[model samples]
Target: MKPENAIEVRDLKKSFKVYFDKGNSLKEKAIHKKRNRYEIREVLKGISFEVKKGEAIGLIGHNGCGKSTTLKLLTKIIYPDSGSIDMCGRVSSLIELGAGFHPDMSGRENIYTNAAIFGLSKKEIDERLDDIIRFSELEEYIDNPVRTYSSGMYMRLAFSVAINVNAEILLIDEILAVGDVNFQEKCFDKLKDIKRAGTTIVIVSHSLDQVERICDRSYWIDEGEIRAEGDPISVHEAYLTAMNQSMQERLEKEDAEVMEQHKKLGQARLMPVFCSDIAERKGTFDVEFSDIKALNSIGEKKRTFHSGEAVRLRFAYKNPNHVPQANIKFSLYRDDGILVYENNYEFATGKVLDLKDEGEVNVEFPTFGYAKGTYLLNAVMYPPGGGEVFDEINNVFKITVFSEERAMGVYLLENHWEEA
Candidate 1:
């Protein structure tokens, strides 16, 4: 029987000694390691929580905000500086999936090693081997060394191994975020099955939608403290608001002129986050609400499309500078580093925003045309002089395209398939 609380943590804290002399050569650190002075970073402060048996929980916060530390501490990868964790059952952690597998080993052999580390018998693994390979969707590559496998493969096999092990507790940190859309969907279905089997799940993710969708509860961590803990929707909302505030703070400190130029751009108002690309593309929908915020609206902009249908992408960003003749450029790439498409605003717009005197411009692109694959958007600010990029967001937006009826390929030709 599962314990009442699958995992219980109290007064948890984890700290690391971060060295500041970034210029110091490796030799210096090796020589003075014992006496080296370092800055103390309290990644996780004193925190406490309990996950009832079969409860699905999420941890969200800014990067380096101690969410990873908490997950690591619970999995015993790194012991807490001070606190206690009471785990009632076996844990299958995908913290840094395949953390200690030998690259020279074939996928089959690595599965044995990974399963053994989780305390599974070789016989147990053998019985589950076919299922593991099938779940991983790498049947043909099972005999190949993991060294030859792509990063995506590593994530697939790692996740497959973790999920297959029949553990009572599962710690997942954006694990499904790695694979392709098809693989991700398969993994999600597996996760739902796991949940149905009553496995306690704890997830750490940058994706608010996933948290809200799968997690029953959520936590927002800030500077090693539990800032909020409650229902997924409420907690995620708090995290989003906190993130936007931090981004604003970072921009304020990055440059003085940035703030001044932002003030000079038309009427100064925060950009309302736009989620509906289809609706926004027609230029007929404002999709605006006084309560809709940039961080909160991020999930809406990313629409999950069926395989054969067209996708409308909407991007809303504040221009920190009031430079005229600035055009937007977008680049689309598959997760495998393949450049699918690229286009520039200079050719699309042919002119500047007349409201350049204003502090901000919220532009929408109804970019439609693509095949079944996940594509990311790379945006850049183009100035007329072309001296340097006034602003740029590298792969800021991502969308996964999948249609059940569409065949897998780079482009969908407007022609019927014919047999030779």
Candidate 2:
């Protein structure tokens, strides 16, 4: 390891044996020996990186991408199959929080045991005991058996002990989600303080925003290899782009298979490419929606849009009965099921839609005035006066809005400030 580096990893590799049809009992194992076949699944493939003292680096990737495995290797919870890892100081890890905790033991007692596992001396633990208890906000329950503690309480106790260890190096793995939102914020603030105090930190997390805020650099691992490593923001942007492209390809393949199935059944079903699986369909089917799409100003299919960007919805319907007139309703909802906006074609234009055997209707929002978040969409067709329902699809499409400005609430209000 270089003198200036707090930690160094060189060509680290690890793999696990994934068994197939393995038996647990001795008798069953003996009788089905041949069924105990397994495969060597390589998780980390010759990955290498270094961190300077006081520097924080984040490992990011989709699940099963070996980032967690790498953390385990650094903490020595698991051994690497090959290569080397060198560290400079005592390490404290939030990975597998409460791993050494005894459920039957009192929370206060478990704190001493957990801190001891981090190589803290009895005197050192005694010095920090009160601080840990205070941070956990569980002083009242500190003497209670951990078995009686809620999951959040247990996590709080464990996190409190680990964070107060003041080790030279901290390894965290998705444990920042512990406790309620307020506690989570407090934990973040504590981490920032730790970083400022010059503790080398390594984090494995799916929350890219957290990584961007705390880490000096990021490594994007994929398929057992480090695909990209650099500034967190740039690395994450590349990672997201690749992931979205892969998802699009997978969705297209699945849509093709569904189309083939529909053809064989001699039925025209909504294309999976346009309709979400969670969409709910109802009504008499007098006029069924054939396809629906969220589009951009250029009429190109799009599900994600920036705040204040033009958004359009195109609805295609099949009216076998040639219903003369119908009212068209469109609704938008936030992810939390809050209705954000609702309108109808008849109400807006003062005329019901004239139906044909097959036709398309388009609704355009010159500027999509919404905050950054996901929203669901609903489309409905009914009689002019809303006596009978023709067709209604709830959550037929999902729209995602992004904004550069940081503000609160569902709608993005347009405003300007003048100094007085």
Best by the TM-score measure? 2
Candidate 2 residue-wise lDDT, 1-420, digit = tens: 798899999999999999887788898788988878889999998999999999999999999999999999999989999999999998989887786899899999999999998889999999999999999999899999999999999999999999999999999999899999999999999999999999999999998899998999999999889999999999988887676666656655665675466566554454334566578888898888888888888887777777898988888988998788888899999999999999998878987788989999888899999997889999888898767788888988677776655568999899899999
* Candidate 1 residue runs with Cα over 4 Å from true position: 1-3, 21-35, 255-420
Local error of candidate 1 at residue 295 (angstroms): 21
lDDT by residue (30-129, candidate 1, tens digit) is 8877547778887888989999999899999888888988998888888998889999888988777786689999999999999888889989999889
Please report how far candidate 2 places residue 60 from its true position, in Å. 1.1
| Cα lDDT computed for each candidate against the true fold | 0.70, 0.88
What's the number of clashes in each of the models?
9, 0
TM-score of 2: 0.85
- On a 0 to 100 scale, what is the lDDT of residue 347 in model 2? 77
Instruction: Assess candidate 1 and give its lDDT.
Output: 0.70
Score residue 203 of candidate 1 by CA lDDT: 94
